[model samples]
Target: MSSLLLRHHRPFLAFWFARVFTASGFQMITVAIGWQMYALTGNVLDLGLVGLIEFMPKILFILITGHVADRFDRRKVAALCQGAQGLIALGLLLGSGAGGISREMIFVIAFLLGTARAFEMPTTQALLPNIVPSNLFPAAVAASASAMQAATIVAPALGGLLYALGTHWVYGPAVVLYSCALSLMLSLPARQLPLKQKVSLESLLAGFRFIRSRPAVFGAISMDMCAVLLSGATALLPVFAKDILLTGPWGLGLLRSAPAVGALLMSLWLTRFPIERRVGPVLFTSVAIFGVATIGFGLSTSLWFSLAALVLLGAADMISMVIRSAFVQLQTPDEMRGRVGAVNGLFIGASNQLGDFRAGVSAAWFGTVPAVMIGGVGALVVTGLWIRLFPELAKRDHMHPQPNPQPPSAAA
Candidate 1:
C-alpha cells in the first residue's frame, strides 16, 4: 500500500489482499500435507511423490489452460478456480476429521488442487496488467511479490504451530481463506479478454512462438527452470526437520517460512527501488547467489544455520523472480498476456513442484545432504552455462518503461 502505484488503486488492493489470503491459506495446506504425508508413510520418497502428483495437472492441462485464459473471461475463470480449490480444501477438512483420509486420497486431492491452480494462476497473473497502468508494472510486481512472501512469512510457521492442534486446525482456515479469495475475484466487474484468434493448434501455440522469438524471456525462464529444478529442496524439509535437525512439525514450518522472510524483505526493498539498469547481469548474479545459499543450507547442521541459508537464497530468488516476471509481462502485449503467462507459469511449476520431485527422488537415492549439495553445484553450473549461452539476458540494461495513458480507470 505504501507504493505510490498501488496507494489509490482500490481494485488492485482487492486483488492484492486476495493474493495475501490465498497464499496464507495454501501455506498452511502445504505444511499440513507434507507433514501429514511424511508422518503417515515415514518414507522420504513419499514426500517426492506428493510433489510429483501435484505437478501432474500442470503437465496435463498446460496447453489448454493458457488458451482458456486468453479466450475466456479471466476474472470468472479465476473466481471459479478459487471456488473449486475451496471445495477441495473443505473435502480435506471433512475427510481428515472423519479419519478417512489416506495417502492415496491426499495425492488425489493434490491433483485436483493443482488442476484448479493451473487455470487460476495465469488468469490472475494476466489480470494485474489490466488493473494497473503499464509503466508502473515493475513496482507492481515487486509489491505483489511482497504480498505473497509476506503471507509465506507468517503462514507456514503459524500453520506449523497450528498443526500441533491437528490438520483440522490447518484445513479449516484454508477453506475460509479460499472463500475470501473467491469472493474478491468475483467482485471485480465483468470484462472480456481480447477475443482470441479462432481456436487451432497454431493459436494455442502462439505463446510458445512468442517466447521463442524473444531470447531474453526464453533465457530468463529456462535459466530459472534449470537452476531451481535442481536446487528446490523444500520437498525434503520434513526430512530435515525430523531426522536431520531433530525438530517436530513446528520446526518444519519455521524452516519453510525462513525463505519467505528473506523474500518478503527483499521484495519490499525492490518495490521502493525497482530494477532500472543492468537487469541481465543483476539477474544472473542473483541466481548465482541462490546456488551458494543452497550449498550453505545443505552443509548446515543446526536449525538456525539452515534458516539463515534458506533466508539468503530466498532473498536472492526474489531478485531473480521480480526481474524475470516484470520483463516477461512488460515485453508482451496484453493480447498475449494470458498465453505468455501460461508458459511462464509452466516454467515456474517445473521449477518449484518438479524441482521438489527431483529433490525428493535425489534425497531418496543419494541421501539428503549430498543430494542438496549436489543440486547447489548444479545450479552454479546452470548459471555459468546460461550466461555463456544467453548473452542478451546478461547484457540487457533497461526494462524499457512503457507509457501509461493515465491513472487506470479500473472498477472503483
Candidate 2:
C-alpha cells in the first residue's frame, strides 16, 4: 500500500500536506477570532456576524468564483487565495500586537478573508478529481479528509493555548502557516482548463441547474445544508466555555478540538474500508446521530460530557460528508466540476456560516442553552422531512451509481 501510494499518488501527498497547513492555519485563526471578539464585546451576536460576513462573499460572488475556477488555472487561483488569507492573518498580527484591534476591524478583515475563501473553496474542491484517477478518487477523498480533520483537531487547541499569551501569538503562527500553504498550492500540478464557451447568464446559473436536476444529489446536498444549518453550535462555544462550563481558554480549546478528533478517526477508518452499501441509509442515519449528539452537547454542563458529545457529532457528520463528497465528485464531469463545486461550496458555506448566525441570534434571544437545544431538535425535524421529501435519497443502494453504459455510435 505504501509503495502504491508513493508511486501513484505523489501529487496527492503534496496536496494532502497542503491541506494540513492551510486548514490548520484557518482553524487557528477562527479560534482566535471567536475568543477575542467575545472577550471584547461580551456579546454573542458578534460571533454570528463574523460567520455572516465571511459567508456573504459566497452569495455575492458564487457565479463569478465558479466561473474563474472553471476557466482559469486552478492551482494559480488557489495559490492567490491562500496568499490573500496570509496577508489577512499578517494584518491581524500587526493590529493585535499594536493593541489597535477592535470588533469593527475584525469584521472588516473577516469580510476580506471571506472573499478569498469564496474563490478558494470551489477551486480547491475541483482540483482533486483532476489529480487522482477516477478509480482511486474515493480513497483520495478519504485520505484528504483525514488530513483536513487532523489539522482541525490540533490547530484550535494550539490557538487556544497561544491565546493565553496574546492574540498576536495566534495570528503570527497562522500567517506563517498560510504562507506554507500558499507555497504548496503553487507546487501542485496544473489542471486542464475547461473548454472555452460563451459567457452568459446561463453559464453562471449552470451549477444550480445541475444540482437541481439530480434527485439524490439534490437530496444529499440539501439535507446537509438544512441539517447543519440547525445543528451548528460551535459559534456559541465561547459562551458555553465561559458561562456554563466555567473553564478558561484551555477547556474551550478542547471543546473545539473534540469534534475534529472524532472526524479524523472516522476519516482514517473510511480510508481503509470505504462504504459499500446502503449509502443513503448511512447518510441519513449519521446525520440523525449528529443531531442527537448536538442535543447531548447542548444539554451537558460538564466539560468532559460536552467534549464527548461533540466528538460523536463530528464523527457522524464526517460519515455523511465523505459519502456526499465522493458521490458528487464522481457524478460530475470535469468540465462542470468547478461550477458544481461552487454551488456545493455555497450550500456548505450557508450550512456553516449562516448556521453560526442562527446560533448566535438565537442565543442572544433565547439564551445559550435553549437556543442550542432547540436547534438540535430542529435538525432532527429537518432530517425526517428530508427523508419524506426526497425518498430517492433513501432508496440509494451504493456510495455512487455505476455509469450508464453508452451505446455504440456510427464512428465506433
Candidate 3:
C-alpha cells in the first residue's frame, strides 16, 4: 500500500478508494433492486424499466452538472451530491420498509438517484486531472476504471447475499458507504480551475462545437455511444439468468459480474502498458470483439459459457474505455474539461441509460435472444462505418500537448 502511494497523489488515492466503496455499495442497491423487483413482479420488462428510470434524470441534467463542475469548487459539489445520494438511499430504505412500496415509487426514487449522479459523475471526472499530473492521467484513468470494475465484481455478489437476507437490509450498508464517500470527498483540498469566462448557454454550445471540431474526440465518443446503445447486454441479464441459463438470482449476480471480471483484468494490463498509438484501430477492434462476445453470450445456453462470453465482452469493452477516455481527457483543454466531460457524460452516460431503455423495450417486444444478438451485430456494423467516416481517428499516430493555461493579458 505504502509502495503504491509512492506512485500517486494521496488525494487521488483517497478518491479511488472512495469510488471503490461507493461503487460497491451502489452495486448492492442495483442488485437488490433488480432481484427484489423481479421477485415481486417476475417480469423481465420490469427489470429493464428500473434502469430506464434510474438513468433518465441523469441524461437530462448531466450537462448542467458538468457546466457547474467547471465553474465552481468541485470538491464541495461532490460532497453535496454524495450527501444527496446517501439521503436518497435512506429514503428508499424507509419506503421499502413501509410495506407500501409501489413500482411508481421505485421509479421516482430511481430518477432522484439519477439526478444526484448527474452532478456527481462530471465532478468526479473533472477532479482527476487536478489531482494528478497530466502525464499520469492515463494510468490514473485505467487504475480508476479497474478499481470500479473490481468493485463491480465484489459488490454484486455481496448484494446477492444481502438480498437473500432481505431487500431492506441492502440500504443500510449503502448509506454507510455513501457516508464514507462523502467524508473522503470533503477531505480533498478545495480546488477550482482558473476560469476564462463565466459559463453561459453560448459557452455550452461552444463546448459541443469544440467536440465537433476534433475528429478523434468525436470518433471516440461516437463509437462508445453506439456500442453501448446497441449492445446493452446487462439490461437483459435477468432474462438470461432466469430463463436462458436456468440459474437463480445467484446466477443473475454472476452473469452481471462476468463482464466486470474481464474488465478488471484488462484495466490492470492497460495501467501497466498504456495505449500509445493507433488508438483508433484499438478502439475499433475492441468494439468488434465486444460485438462478437455479446453475440456469443446471446447464443449460449450453459451458465459457464454465457459467463465466459460476458468476460470476453468485458475485456474488449475495457480497450474501448481506456482509449476513449484518454483521447477525451488528453486532447481537451483544461478550461473546458468539465463541460467537455459533461458532454461526454451526455453521449457516454446518456447513451448507456438510453441503451438500457432500448434493451428493455426490445427484449420485451422481440424476446431476449434476438434482442441481444441483433444489437451485437448492429454494434459490429456501426464500428465498421465509423472507422471509414472518421479517418483522422484512424490515421492519427501521435498525441500533442494542448496550449497551456495563459495568464491574463493585463489587469482590468
Q: Candidate 1 residues 1-412, lDDT tens each?
A: 4556656677778888888888898888899999999989988888888888888888898789888888888888988998898898899899999998889998998888889988888899988887776676656777788889989989999999999988898999999999999889877765555754888888788889999898888999899989999999999999999999999989999999999999988888887777889888899999999999999999999999999999999999999888788778768877778888888988999999999899988998999999999999999999999999998788888876436579767896
Question: What number of backbone clashes does candidate 3 have, counting pairs of residues 3 or more apart or in separate chains?
Answer: 0
* TM-score of each candidate structure, all chains considered together: 0.95, 0.96, 0.92
lDDT of 2 by residue, 1-412 (tens): 2345558878888788877888988988899889999999999999999999989999999999988888899888988998999999999999988898899999998899999999999999989887888777766777778888888999999999999988888999888988888888888787565648777999888999999998888888889999999989989999999999999887788888999999998888877788889888899999999999999999999999999999999999999898788768878888788899999999999999999999999999999999999989988998899989988788788876669899888874
Instruction: State in Å the error of residue 91, model 3.
Output: 1.9
* lDDT for position 333 in model 3: 77
Give the better candidate number (1 or 3) by TM-score: 1
Candidate 3, residues 306-335, lDDT tens digits: the string is 999999999998888777787788777777
Q: Report the C-alpha displacement of residue 296, candidate 2, in angstroms.
A: 0.5
Predictions: Cα RMSD each = 6.0, 3.2, 5.4
Candidate 3 regions exceeding 4 Å error are 1-8, 399-412
Per-candidate clashes come to: 0, 0, 0
* Cand. 3 TM to true fold: 0.92
RMSD of 3: 5.4
Highest lDDT, which number? 2
Question: TM-score of the candidate numbered 1?
Answer: 0.95
Model-by-model lDDT, in order?
A: 0.88, 0.89, 0.80
